[model samples]
Target: MGRMSDEPARWTRATVYPDMWVDPADDPRDGASPDGELATLLDFLSGYRMTLRMKCEGLDAEQLARRSVPPSTMSLLGLLRHLAEAERDWFNWISDDDPLPKLYGERDGDFDGAVGEQAAVDAAYADLEREQAATDAALAEHPDLGERLRKDGIAVRELMVHRIEEYARHCGHADLLRECIDGRVGQ
Candidate 1:
């Protein structure tokens, strides 16, 4: 017995709660109380990261790279690339004497170059994971949230908050893009 001929090509919602992405018990975000400012910020950041991954789950290269809301080039693949680039910049900024070059070249290259190809999709995920790990390590170097990234730049706390804000915004775009591709919707 294999997949029925009448079954959809891709998996659709079949949870007890039809409107959500997954059952509450299966959600990956941590529910434990954070211990401090740094812990709280990190929790939010981690949750947003999981949310973005959840939005991109089960998508193929074409679906991941599909643009959403006419006139906007935003896509889940693009967001993944953009976030990777962002992590490199912000995390490395603290130790750099000068500004680093864009990971994808041009300012909008992350979104503009998000082609629907298996290699591109694989690269995006790899880049994001590598960058995220590096960023986390860089962030851990300075336990002080008040530590300034640069003499005239913002502090670690501010940078962390900004990074979370960026993820939250892009995750919103991911949500819409995923829904447009398939009609799946959830928090």
Candidate 2:
């Protein structure tokens, strides 16, 4: 039976697949294995991005901005903003030809400014979309992963690997935060 309106929130939702957030048939992530190094990295990044979004799905602005653990201001919304800023910093701003300012005023502004307001939530998502597109476009300009950015001495391959690491770590955080929020877990 479905939940009743008068009942309190349950720790876990009743589902056929209790260990996963979605059924395998309904999962949005591209499950197919990749053929090359670049494709593999891209695939993992794409899946992590989708996973982060799924973790935040059905959550309201207040829930999105809820603090993670004690003494840490990090939240789903903050992660979104931080990732957007990171995409710009690593891809666009690092290139000398298109150096740009931080999306937020300061380095920690993403987490510090995260508020439980609809406007803030909407802005964070929009900024993420814009920054992701800009970053992708900038990366497309340099097909050779061995080529270094004009400003940063690191190769594109290193940058891609670093981004994957960053996303994977944050996705783990998202998983814990989401579980604490509603008792949902898996995948």
Candidate with top lDDT is: 1
Lowest-lDDT window of 10 residues in candidate 2?
5-14
Q: For model 1, state the Cα shift of residue 165 in Å.
A: 0.7
lDDT of 1 by residue, 82-187 (tens): 9999988886677665665678998899999999999999999999999899889878988898888766677989889999999999888887778788877756
Give TM-scores for every candidate, taking all chains together and pairing residue i with residue i: 0.88, 0.88
Clashing pairs in model 1, backbone N/Cα/C closer than 3 A? none
Q: Candidate 2 residues 1-187, lDDT tens each?
A: 9756632343444366767787677788947889988888888888888888998899999999988878998998899999988888886644666468888897699999999999999999999889888777778787788887765477888888888898889999898878767777747
Candidate 1 displacement at residue 97 in angstroms: 4.5
Candidate 1 lDDT (Cα, whole model)?
0.85
TM-score, candidate number 2: 0.88
